[model samples]
Structures are given as structure tokens and as C-alpha cells.
Target: DAGVTQSPTHLIKTRGQQVTLRCSPKSGHDTVSWYQQALGQGPQFIFQYYEEEERQRGNFPDRFSGHQFPNYSSELNVNALLLGDSALYLCASTAGGKGHAPAKNIQYFGAGTRLSVL
Candidate 1:
């Protein structure tokens, strides 16, 4: 398995629209992280989920939301999107355990979903 996979490799939307992206984590991974990467920029953290709950979040607005299922798959939802929201949405998976520091957990990334908003 490729560790992580995302659906709708490419998507197109207009301003004020909403979008949903899906992700499936690798086997044995219990944590999921979402990121946004703009052209010529590094991936920006959006949030992290563990045990079907949001554990950490970045400096994004409430329009960005996500949910994790018991199976560890996740979906990221962006509402009322703007042109600036056009970017690559990335999904990463890692293992979570007692005494395991977040920074120490190795994250495996998916190819990412490219979103274009006009």
C-alpha cells in the first residue's frame, strides 16, 4: 500500500463554493493530518485528528473542518471557498501511542488533491 491516498486528484470550483476531500490512512496509522500547499510554497498545516477527534489545528478559519472515522479515514471540508483557497490539499498519516511525541511520529503523505477555485 502507498501508505496514504486521496480522492479526486483534481478539482475545480468557483468562488463561494464548498468542497470536500477524502483520505485513507495506511494500516496501523492512527493519526491524520491535513495540509494546504500553494504554488511555490511549503505545505501549511491545517489540522490533525486522532481517535476521531481533532487534536491540533493550525491558523486557519472555521471554514476549514475535518472528521475522522473509526477506520482512520478522514474528510476535509472547506466551505464558502475563496480564490485564495486554490491549492493542493494534502493528507498525512502517522501512528499515535502513549508517550509518543507528535514531533517524533513519522508522517506519510498522500499525493494530494489539487483544487482550483476561480
Candidate 2:
């Protein structure tokens, strides 16, 4: 019954350096999605992965990318980061074997990796 987990609960980076964040899905879950939440805005979907392949993507630029390993864990990589990139990065998981929720399935989020770009 483990829930999603993220590493480095918080992070700080310069405007152009890169950063990598990690996520482990909940028990028995097979899908992972990434989201970015600005200071006062709702979470914005970055992308989703299932079966290790990207299933869907949002409007983010190519600077954002990710990988899901065989163990259903994931990593989010942001390169040449910008000041605006500073925000909370969330990792959400859903069990593929279960039925999708009425509202496109609820995404259970980790506390999130808070990135601060200088």
C-alpha cells in the first residue's frame, strides 16, 4: 500500500543548469504523469507514460522530458532551465488495471519536488 514517493523534497538551481527529479509509483500502479504547478496556479500536465512509452503530452516545450523504468519508477529531466521553471514538480500515478475515474481518473500526487531556479 505504498504511495508515490519523490526525492530531494526540495531543490535549487541556477538559471541555466539542469536538474533531475525522481518518482516511484504506488504499489500495483503502472502509469506515471508529471505536472508543474506555479506559485498560484493549478497543476499543469506535462506528460504521461505507460508501458515505458509516452502516452500523452501537454503543451510544454522540448526542454522537458522524462523516462519510466521497468520498475514503474520515473525521472523528470529539465535542461537549460529557465528562471520561470522554478515551481513544484509533481508525480502522479494511477493503476492501469483499475477502471478510469469518471473525471479521467484521479491523479494521486506526491508532496512534489520543489525546484528553485535562480
Candidate 3:
């Protein structure tokens, strides 16, 4: 009955370092989305995954990547990190796929992982 969950609640890294953030979706949810939120700014969409495949992506550079597992868990990987990448990374899950109405795809979010790059 737990909602979406993310790990390593906080992290610190240097420029050019790589980081991986993890998330487990809520029960019965098969889709996941990743977002980055900077201070005083709204969350920016990164990408979405369904059926273990990336279904959509935002304007982020190739340094951002992700994967969805069979169990609906997901991992967001960022490579060659930059100072601008410092932010709160959020994970959201919702029931998705065919036959589900767009309105029903109400996303449930996790507490998020805060990453800081120096």
C-alpha cells in the first residue's frame, strides 16, 4: 500500500561525476516519470517510462538517462554531471497503458532525491 519511493534522499558530487537515483512505483502502477526541480522553480519533466521502455522525453541533454524494470521500479542515471544539475530529482508513478483514460493517470510522487554538484 505504499506510494512511490525514492532512495539516497541526499547526495553530493563534483562536476563530471555520475549519479544514479532509484524509485519504486506504487502498487499496480506500471509507468514512471522523472522530474528535476530547482530552487523556486517548478518541476521540469525529464522523461517517462512504460513497459520497460522510454515513452517520452523532455529537452534534457543526453547526460540524462533512465530505465524501467519489469516490477515497475525505475532508475534515473545522470552522467557528466554539471553544476546546473543540482536540484531535487523527483519520481512519480501512475497507472498507465492502453484503456486508461488520460485523466486517470494521476501521478503519485516520492519524497525525492536531492543532488548537489559542485
Residue ranges of candidate 3 with Cα displaced over 4 Å: none
Q: Per-residue lDDT of 2-98 in model 3, one digit per residue for the tens?
A: 9999998999999999999999998888899999999999999999999999999999999999999999999999999999999999999988863
lDDT of 1 by residue, 1-118 (tens): 5579999899999999999999999777888999999999999999999999999999999999999999989999999999999999999998874336865398889999999999
User: Considering lDDT, which of the candidate structures 1 and 3 is the better prediction for this target?
Assistant: 3
lDDT of 3 at 1: 95
How far in Å is the alpha carbon of 23 misplaced in model 2? 0.3
Give me candidate 2's TM-score against the actual structure: 0.93
User: Regarding lDDT, does 1 or 2 come out ahead?
Assistant: 1
- Evaluate residue 50 in candidate 1 and report its C-alpha lDDT on the 0 to 100 scale: 94
The lDDT values for all models are 0.93, 0.92, 0.95
Error of 2 at 55 (Å): 0.6
Best by lDDT: 3
TM-score of 3: 0.96
Alpha-carbon shift of residue 101 in model 2 (angstroms): 4.8
RMSD of 2: 1.6
